[model samples]
Target: MIQIVPIDTPTLGDRSYLVGDGTVAFVVDPQRDIDRVLDLAARHGLRITDVFETHIHNDYVTGGLALARATGAAYHVNAADPVSFDRTPIRDHDVVEVGERMRVRAVATPGHTFTHLSYVLETPDRAPVVFTGGSLLFGSTGRPDLLGPSHTDELVRAQYASAHRLTGGLPDDTEICPTHGFGSFCSATQSEAERSTIGREKQVNPVLTQDEESYVEQLLAGLDAFPAYYAHMGPANTAGPAAVDLAEPRTADPAELRARIDAGEWVVDLRSRTAFAAGHLAGSLNFGLDGSFATYLGWLIPWGTPVSLLGDTPEQVAEAQRELVRIGIDRIESSATGEPEAWSGAAPLGTFPRASFTDLAAVRHHRAVTVLDVRRDSEWAGKHVDGAVHVPLHDLLHRLDEVPRGEVWVHCKSGYRASIGASVLAAAGHRVVVIDDQFDQAENAGLPMTA
Candidate 1:
């Protein structure tokens, strides 16, 4: 029996799959975190046979070449536009046999890119499975407009033809496995579900239903701002990511931690937003352990910047270090040792300006206070505190002039971005406070708020 394993892409709702016949396996569209894939293959007693790239991904870095180098597996991409890497290039109609029962047939599926392909796995007694890559997604199709101005009508038409070729020719029972889930930028209408079938997609996916012209128009219409970092990631993936081989994190004693901090080394607090808000080292930046941990770390901290992580547990510290390495930020010194002892005599702990109903009521009595809500516009519209100014954190850098120069209270759902916002405001010499608690705390406290 063949097995398919999904590797989670943290922060982004993306997934990559490993398919094999127990003894030998192949990986498709691997995310930057390759250890999980390697561990999965070892646990199942399978040797990695090949690494395949469906297309150049724009969100997270691809781990295809990295995995191939580590496992000595042959890397494969379409020969039409061969990936400039050290690998074996396969063409259309090429067959890669995995075992007696399973074989991968590479079918050129373009439109998402000039050189995109989907691999179909054929097995006896079961319908073939199509690793659609970005060409076909559940309830949607990959955007044809990612190529920018080069994505003219001709390219869009080519993409439509590619979608038709796959959906029109594939067996109804063939499973459709995609690299990205819902909320990914690769496809406009990415489904929240990680995986779906060809039959299910044919019924609901609008891009598949439309004629060629309409499909192109619909895809181009929804193209929003692509991340600035995407341009660099494709080339990085095509070449290969640098290997991360740091030793196990050694926790620093208080004296050592202070020395590093005083020497101007960055101290990254890896606890949850709430924990960091409760108490953290003075002047340290708090980046929580939720989604986008690595991406944001790479964005905020320069490459090779010496970083010391402070987390609730040793496991969290290790996870943070691994994530940083995924994006090529690899100058980690060590995690803070004796988390409790390190805090001793560090500085007086300061609370994030959490507003209970009573606190909000007290603030409401003051006529000169301003509540700045740093949440996305969509989130603010869905629900929000009354009379709060909605300025999304990403846009805050440019729109700082819009915020009132008064006693300002910054807030988000919790105090993560709000704390960052508060620090930004404080740096600008504004009187600022961060509320890092649930909104209900204010309501339950009978604090007056407008919708």
Candidate 2:
């Protein structure tokens, strides 16, 4: 019987599955960090026999090539994809034997990408399970616009057809696993579900339920800006990504960090917003390794820019490195770990105060303080302090001067970006206050807000 293990890469909100028959396994849709996949197999006493790629992943680098090479397992990709490297090319209806008794059959399902495919797993006695990588997501389907405007309509039609292809013939009880659209940029809408079946998806998935033309219209209209790094990923995957380097990165003392910072390299602080606000390196930007580190960092940090990491522990640095590398962000120059004061050589460490939104409201004049909302444009348009200066966090570094002079009070939907923004203002030698609270509180408390 096939025992499927879902290895969660929380950083990507993506899952890489291990489908095996107690002896050998096939890892499906793994991220660039292969050690986790390998370690999972080792712990289970199973040898990985193959690594599968459902499509040319755009959000993050694939570990299929690297994992296959490391385990002597064949790497499989769609036969039609224009990959430069050697791989065991697969086609629709092809069945690959994995382990002693488990089998995976490829089903042609194009939508998110031109060559995407979903796989059906059949074990000894259990019902079939379909792994839909970028098509037939839980409540939605993969966005068709990632390939640019030229391909949007064509891919949208293809996506509509692909949705029915699964629901049309598959048994209602067939368990379905989707890799994207669950808080992934590749998805058009976020699927707020962790588990779903073919029957359930047929009832709820937009493409499956709506008229084709209407679905197309809604999808086209809903497309938003995906991560900028997405433009770089397709080319890198097509050219064949190099195996990821998982070795612990080299460390830098404070002097080396200072030189790099002065030389225009990034210094990312991977700590909690609370911890970072207490005190941190003067010029470092706070990304807080706990949140959507890769997505935000990839969005804001320029492509191929060199960076240094400062974290409280080696584990934090290692975790941050893994997330960054998945986006082909391999230019991490150096790292520093432990308490901030342990490392010396920079200007005096700086700090700022975090205030509750209620606290800010209770004490003072809205006109007197400069309240800067650092959320995205969409968020700002939805609701914000009436007199606040709007600067999306991603655009803050470049538009620093646009912020009005005087005490700066920063906020986002939540306190996360507020802390990051506060750090930017603090580093620039401005008096900063992080309005560290929920946006809802500001709105519900009758603070003048305009949507």
Best by TM-score: 2
lDDT of 1 by residue, 153-181 (tens): 66667767877788788888889888765
lDDT of 1 at 202: 76
Cα error of candidate 1 at position 255, Å: 6.9
Q: lDDT value for candidate 1? A: 0.72
- Candidate 2 CA-lDDT value: 0.85
Task: Please provide, for model 2 over 401-451, each residue's C-alpha lDDT reduced to its tens digit, 9 standing for 90 to 100.
Answer: 999888888999889888878887886778999988889999666678787
Candidate 1 C-alpha RMSD relative to the actual structure: 3.9
Colliding pairs, model 1: 11-292, 111-159, 252-337, 386-450
Question: Which candidate number would show the highest lDDT if scored against the true structure?
Answer: 2
By TM-score, how accurate is candidate 2? 0.94
Compute the lDDT of residue 129 as modeled in candidate 1. 92
Worst 10 residues of 1 by lDDT: 337-346
TM-score of every candidate relative to the true structure: 0.83, 0.94
